[model samples]
Each structure stands twice: as structure tokens, then as C-alpha cells.
Target: MPLATEMFEGHAINRSAAERRAATLTARRSVKKLHQAAWLVNAIRCIDLTTLAGDDTAARVRRLCAKALNPLAPHIKEGLGLGDMRLTTGAVCVYPTMVRHAAEALEGSGVPVASVATGFPAGLMPLDLRLAEIRYAVTEGADEIDIVITREHVLTGNWQALHDEISAMREACGKAHMKAILATGDLQTLRNVYAASMVAMQAGADFIKTSTGKEGVNATLPVSLVMIRALRDYGAATGYRIGFKPAGGMKAAKEALAWQILMKEELGREWLNPDLFRFGASSMLGDIERQLEHHVTGRYAASSRHAIA
Candidate 1:
């Protein structure tokens, strides 16, 4: 669809109400024992296990890929009766230069390699340079490209500019899927978050991401509620189901359950799939693995035992 400001313009988001609703999502729906294990397993499938640091290396990316291939330890998998389940993370995300390493390592495993491109973490570069970065990532064998949107466009109410920028980046992605990072923390208000989300989806973003993890705040439930509502409204209008990712500041098994619960309640069970939802996390996997191990052994394992990379 084209840029449609009418969909989100003047849309009112009550922060207090959103916060109240988000709070209940976790408190009211509590899974225990086997059900909890099942949800955690499902969460593993929706995780975009990521490594996007300034000092990221090919070796580090390879190790990360290895973890994605076999997230749970053999003992934990066996204890849980997951015999040859072939569980793997939804994808492995990395810097553009590290895409080749992840692509080669995850080849034949049915796992996609996602690259954070278009001047990721802060898309402050020239549009041409950003588009070129996307092309480079695609040429490097990235199946998905995570592009960051310019916060200024949202802050200054430049919907046309924001839409045009993301649309061009989407074009540059070619055959690869594009996840537009809204960087909602910098957008100030929940209204801005909703508007940016609508514009990103209108510009053909396969997924609308909450943050880049470098902001002062990232992936709060209230902000996520606004984005999820925008996603629901867009689906209603266009009949197109878009994905959602809440990146950064999510580092616990409980947080994973909360977000999954949010998706299940707000968007139906269909959104629980990796194709529609994902957690952009690195260390969160460790916590999830730790919790699973405890569920199996009845004793909490040392955090080192579940180290991701």
C-alpha cells in the first residue's frame, strides 16, 4: 500500500489506558509447569537471536549461529522429551559485514540470516548510502534486512519523508524481507509511535520493530501496545498481516512470556509465529535456557551453563 496518513493521523493513544492494559497482559495470564514449558519453547522459535555490537567479529557471529542451530543443550532437550525436535531460533541477526559468516554457517539449516543495515542503530546517514547498505547486505546473503528509520522524520511530523525513506529501503532489499525499526523511544509520544508504525507498514515493512536498543528507553510495554494496536488497525484496513518485533531491554524468560502473551491476546494465536512476531534478543536466550533447564532438573543451573556465545 502507499503512504496513507489518513489511517493514523490524529489517532489518539491514551498512555494511561495502554499502560493499564499492558500491565494486565502479564499478570492475568500465567502459565505453569508443562504449559509454561510449551510457551517457552514457542518463544524460542520466535526469537531473532542477535549480535549487533561495534566489536562484532566473524568468529563471534559463527558462534552465535551455532547457538541458533541448537539453542537448548542436549540434556535439556532430552529431559524435556524433545527427541530430535530440531528446534532452532527464528533467525540470526548481525551487522551487514557479518551476514556472510552467518549465512555460510546457517546454510542448509533452514534458518534465515538477518542483517541490520541502512545505517542501523541510528539511521542518520544519507538515503543513498543507506540504500546501498541494504543492497550490500542482500548481496552478502542476508534473507532479512532490519533498517532503522530516521527519528527526525517522526519527531518533526514528516510522514511523507519517513514513508519515502522506508519505501526506498524496502526497494533496496530486493528479494529480502525488510523490518523497519521505528526507534519509538526517541519519538516521544505514543501517538508518534502509532503514526510511525502506520507509515512503516504503509511503506511495505514486513515487520515493525520497536527500537534499536541504543536509545535511552526501549521496548516498553506501553509503547508496544500502541504499535500492536496500529498493526491490528492496519491489518483491518489492508487485510495484510505484518510482523512485530520488540527489540532491546528484553532479557528475561518472564519478559518473553509477557510479550508472547501480549501477541496471543491482542493479535490472536497466528501472530505467535516467527513469521509474524520475533524478539530481537541475544542474552534473553540464556535466561530462557536457564529456566527450561530448571524446569527439567528441578534445580537452577549456573548462568554460565546457558551462555549464548
Candidate 2:
């Protein structure tokens, strides 16, 4: 796991082939009725229900935590016959400063508080500053730290620099899990995405994230396919399973189903669980709730009824 450039240096990702495979994922695998409801429920468990706005407040974070705690309404939970299932989102993600509020709100509920550190959505900050940010978030009770990588490292083919930076951040994280955000949209090419993913895993990232959700293009299936393949390859070589998270620009139950399908087909059904996969979403849960309501009552509910906050 020590900067294995031989694993991906000359990797060639056929763009057209990736697109074609991504296009066929949803069409080829279809889940409907009860099966669809089941998959959506599983997706709810794997969601990093998030709030990362510039104006985020403790009150808003508390409300989001409330949602993460009880994702389904009483009526819907009853209709689905979950029977004290205690369903909750995988984690609640917020900015580093808000970690304490979210941690307090979700305490004793078996839900983790994930904080975005190291200058989220952009890793242009100084290295020491970034590591300090990770430590600060950990001190604030963040169970997971989502750190962004320097896109310039990937762009300029500085694999050692990238590995060393991520390795330092990982050490700063200590016991807290670290998710390395590739910001794949900024990486320019699928091959870069693959190589960045490999290096992040080699450097001790517990997870490799697709985007920060700020880029013009975030979490496209083709880009995700390349990343998944990289993780799959890394697992094959190291026997260490790394998690995958697709963040940003996803807001539909259908999209959730599609990504789950991709994980199932590529990495087996084990990846469908929260420990292995997560959807970094805020709005996607509302749509998933609405779809579940429709599945229960055979009638679509108004979008406002499923507001996350």
C-alpha cells in the first residue's frame, strides 16, 4: 500500500466504454414494488444525511439530526411493518465548526457525526492548517473526517506529494475514519480519478469520495465507475476493503437505486451496506421518503410533506 504507481500509472480508461456501461446500469437492473421499497430503505441506512450550507446554524443542524434519527414518519414506518427496526441514517455530516452541535444532537442514537475538514470543497489551504482542522474536528467529536485532496497534485502527476499529504491527514485523524474527497470533476480525466483513488487508499483513507458536491459535474456514473474499479483493484491487491461515497448532484430515488445497483454489480451485495457505501446527500432523502410513501399508500405525497428539516 506504499504508493503503488505500478497499479495505475499507465491505466487507460476508455471514456466511451465507461459511459456506455454507466448508461446501461439503470436500464439493465430494475427493482420495483416491494423490492424497490426495500432497496430505498437500505439506501436510507447508507445515507450521510448532510447540511453544509454557508449559513448553517446549530438549530438547522439539530433539525437535520432529528431527521437522521427518525427518517420515516410514524405512519410510514407502521405501514412498512418495520416493527421497532430503529432505522437511522448512516451518519450526519456537517462542517467542522458544527460537529459539536450535531454530535450532541445525535448522541446515544448509534449515528456518527461526520465533519468536513481540511478546507472542504477545496484543498487550497496550507498543509499544517489542514491537519489542524482535522484534529479540531476530532476534538469536537466528529467520528469521521471528510478531507479534500489537492487537485493540483493529481493534475501534475505528483503521486508522492499526494500520498504524503493524505498520509499526514490520516495520521491527524487518529481513530476517526478519514474520507478523501477526490473532487473528481476537477481532476479532468478518468485516469486521474483512478490514480488519485489508488493513492488515497494506499495513504490510509478509510473511504474515497467522488466529489465535494461543489464542482460543475459531481458524482457522474462514469467517473464513479472508474473510482470503484480502482477500489476494487486496491482491495484485490491489499485485501483491505475501502468504502466509497458519491456526493453531490444526486436528488432522486432513482439515482439512489442506480448507484446501489452499480455497487452490487461491481463489488457484490456487501457494498450495499453503510460500512461499505454511502450517499453524501441532503435532498435525496426527501425524494426517497416520498417514494416510500407512494409505495405504502399507492399515492404520491406532496414534496413539502417530506422536507428533511
lDDT of 1 by residue, 1-309 (tens): 778789998789888999999998898999999999999999999999999888999989999999999999999999999977989999999999999999999999999999998888888899999999999999999999999999999999999999999889989999999999999889999999999999999999999999999999999998999999999999999899999999998999999999999999999999999999999999899989999999999999887667556
TM-score of 1: 0.99
Deviation in Å, model 1, residue 91 alpha carbon: 0.3
TM-score to native of every candidate shown: 0.99, 0.99
Find the 10 residues in a row with the least total lDDT in model 1. Answer: 300-309
Candidate 2 lDDT, 1-309, residue by residue in tens: 578899999989999999999999999999999999999999999999999999999999999999999998888988899968989999999999999999999889989999999988788999999999999999999999999999999999999999999999999999999999999999999999999999999999999999999999999999999999999999999899999999999999999999999999999999999998999998899999999999889999987777556
Cα lDDT of all candidates, in order? 0.93, 0.94
Query: In angstroms, how far off is 186's CA in candidate 1?
Result: 0.2
| lDDT score of residue 203 within candidate 2 | 96
